[model samples]
Target: MEPKININNSTHFSWLSCWPQWTGYAAALWSLLYGLLGLYWFLGGNGFPFGKNDSRAEMMGSFLSNLNVDVGGPVIAIAGLVGTVVAIAMKMTWGSRFHRAIFLSYAWIMSVTLIFIVPDSRIVQNFAYLFLLHFDLLDWRVINQVFCIVGGFIWGASAIAYFRLTQNACGNCGRNDATEGSSAKATAKWGKWFTYFAVIMALPYGIVRWAWALGIPLGTNDSSMVGNEDNVRVEAILGGLCIGGGVLTLGLIQRWGVIFPWWCFFLAGKQIPIWFVMVPAMLMSTIITITGLKLSPQIIFMMVNGSITNENWGQFVPFLFWLPWGISLGIAILAYYLKRRGRCKHCGKL
Candidate 1:
């Protein structure tokens, strides 16, 4: 049968199609929840309705403290709204291409902003203080729950759509007819290998996180020695694991193969799909690696000043892990899938 092509005027590649339905669904949900939470923060309101840290006044005060009322305030609010709306719109069948562009733009801008803000010692300290002071004044728990649920729903819906779009036997890039030879075999072979690579890279990290959460003390150290010695160790180990794993995975993707382990036969000169799988994997891994590297110093400072103690450091932890990790992971998976669909069936090349 001839391959198919996606002719929906969607210039942007559908990278999320590589993984199972659940991956896209989960990612979409995470993006939406994070986007909405960011929106709430920008709007000078607490998204969490019932948590101790869910105070509008405190959130607003924090915003004002870090951002100038005239420039920063308006920019944040407008950006937040636009970003949230665009993210939601991307799930729709008609405007997904445009919406995806907008969503990516927003994410990039916010990521840059976070990079600048997180490094500033003064900003980190003040933000932490503000959050602690107003912790109990707002209703954050409910708001957070709502965001989670809504975000999950969006993710689920978008994931379904993405899956349907990719599963079409039609090839991407409108290359329905092509030569048949070694290329076909190569394409099929590489596709499976790439999928395996992604799974292998992601599995260990997930396992480590799960073990850490379960109090396994699996050699995790705290990059920011904020509280008890034990807590510091735990955080450092986990943080280090994430940062290190991401870096190693990225390096492997870049190198394509290595020559150390005797058990591995394809360790020397395996030319994987560089454009599709390798590039996207590297991009995703870079996000996490860079964020971890950048945030290390700031987290250390916070720990030293007692601004973020063991008991209260949980608040910042999510931001530290989720932002870069989630974004990168989503992009990586999406890119892989898109590349898979776009590959030349006969040549096995993208």
Candidate 2:
């Protein structure tokens, strides 16, 4: 006879009951470590992430690049200490509405600043470079930015868990029995529109890029943009990514998002894991938003100075929509999550 196994008695199942508390602890630990790193930088330990030490620093282009170590370092250290305190407080189940509001706002502000503001285009560019097997862009700057992004994610998760707990909702599913039917349904309703909008935003860039790759000047008179084989390869790769990502965005609202599509061969008809789709979509959305914001200052300056002429306007124009594309995609992802995250096993909420 086969051995009987009691999965409920397994150690892996133990953490679920107290996951919110654990997440808060993790956020606190991250804040403390980051604070210490800031203190080290303030004390003139080498490798501060901003200003003169950052090789990619361009005045007026990056916010961090303008922050001198003497000022930014101590500020960072102080902020981290405060963040640690906030994380610890959030872990507990105490506080009035006003106090909770302040802490939650701080948590979200830190999350947004770390994930979206601290990172520049280099992080996204590194992904492209990595595709070409180039290792030069994989430097300490990228690593530091990635570290900040991880901290952002930890804090965001902790804040969300805290929110659910405070509201007396199911922590696993974020649904209050008293207010269950309205929010999720409404979000899912609006999600379809956001998905369509996201798809539309990507089309122009993808089409123009593909046109350029094929030696056709869709917006410019010059075909020299793709005259060389290397340039053509780069254009093609970027075009493919834009188009492919747009297609994948549609999956968020489609049947295939929940069940494997026929294209999956043996995996077809299988129920898709939510994280498999959610993780990539959320990460890509964040990257797109960061890239758009990072490039805005320089790009806008170029436009103002008439540096971007008719011959090159096409390449730069479509990217200006990246910020909106990212935001819409993010909303769509949230909607999809609300729609699909049904029947939480831990909380037994439907």
TM per prediction: 0.31, 0.90
How accurate locally, in lDDT, is each candidate? Answer: 0.42, 0.80
Model 2, range 312-331, lDDT digits (tens) per residue? Answer: 88877777877788889999
Candidate 1, residues 158-256: lDDT per residue as tens digits?
Answer: 444443343342332323234322243444445444434543444444444444555553433453334444554554455455455555444332334
Judging by TM-score against the true structure, name the best candidate.
2
Error of 1 at 14 (Å): 10
Candidate 1 lowest-lDDT run of ten: 118-127
Candidate 1 is scored at a TM of 0.31
- Best by lDDT, which number? 2
C-alpha lDDT (0 to 100) for residue 94 of candidate 2:
49
